[model samples]
Target: MMRSSVRGFSLVELLVSVAILGLLASIAMPVVELTQKRQREANLREALRSIRHAIDAYKDASDHHRIAVDNGASGYPPSLLDLSSGVTDLNSPDGPKLYFIRRIPRDPMNGDISVDAIKSWGLRSFASPYDAPRSGNDVFDVYSTSTEVGLNGIPYSEW
Candidate 1:
């Protein structure tokens, strides 16, 4: 019988390819994880911005007397629910009228409406108005309570 040439990857070649693929995957996994983490941080940041804007709008209306200051209350809504469901008596010179946010945003991390229960969200009350040191009069700000620093080397609370 005549010798025939075979056209196929050698064992060494196959092994080398698999090794290269494994190395690539190993190198890529962490980068992918980091990217995903960063994206989550960005989402949290955006959510915070939206919530803060809503709070400010409420405050502005209150300050202008367009909306009542919840009667004997020193600040805005005590809880996130207050912003959504709680009613405010707006003394708009017309009379004491009721007003409130149509809805409160769901915490992205917690995937729920109640931030306190989840404990994943941080509160920035009227006293602190910042992420660090949870000391405050009332909840003025909200942030992710996650202590893990992000790929950016910044604390999640700071995000």
Candidate 2:
């Protein structure tokens, strides 16, 4: 007696294969989410650092009389725009413009793409308290406007 040979996988075999694939996909979902979060966090850190450094550079330039300052000015940029838009250099002949960061970076933690990148950040002026950031005459520092907590358990605003 001769038995028929199956040319392809049986129904049970296909079902088992699908189940295994589904299981793997489910298992990978959380890891993919975690990786995405980590990447966003890293981006947040870099954006903060770059903006902060630009602020510092602007301040240093002001302190050294490189950038023109008005009477009673805090030596900080009047706005985040100044960092990217550039400032008139007082020290340079013919007043060449000085630029800090090429452009203001969007806050990675801020999910609102509708808002402008500059507006997405919480600005602090020199007059504002360190613990309580507020916008005033000049932009002294920037923080994420997002209130969400990071994977590190620290609020994005505080980061």
Q: Which candidate is the best by lDDT?
A: 2
Tens-digit lDDT string for candidate 2 (28-105)? 999999999999999999999999999999999999999878899999999999999988888774766999999999
Which regions of candidate 1 deviate over 4 angstroms?
3-7, 86-119, 128-137
Model 2 earns a TM-score of 0.94
Q: For residue 145, what is the lDDT in candidate 1? A: 62
In candidate 1, what are the lDDT values of residues 40-157, reduced to their tens digit? Answer: 7777777778778767766766677765455766566566665665454555455543445555555555655544442556677675634355735556777776667776788766
Pick the TM-score winner: 2
Q: Which pairs clash in model 1?
A: 68-90, 124-140, 124-141, 125-138, 125-140
TM-score of each: 0.71, 0.94
* Model 2 stretches with alpha carbons more than 4 Å out: 1-5, 93-95
Q: After superposition, how far is residue 52 of candidate 2 from its true place, in Å?
A: 0.4
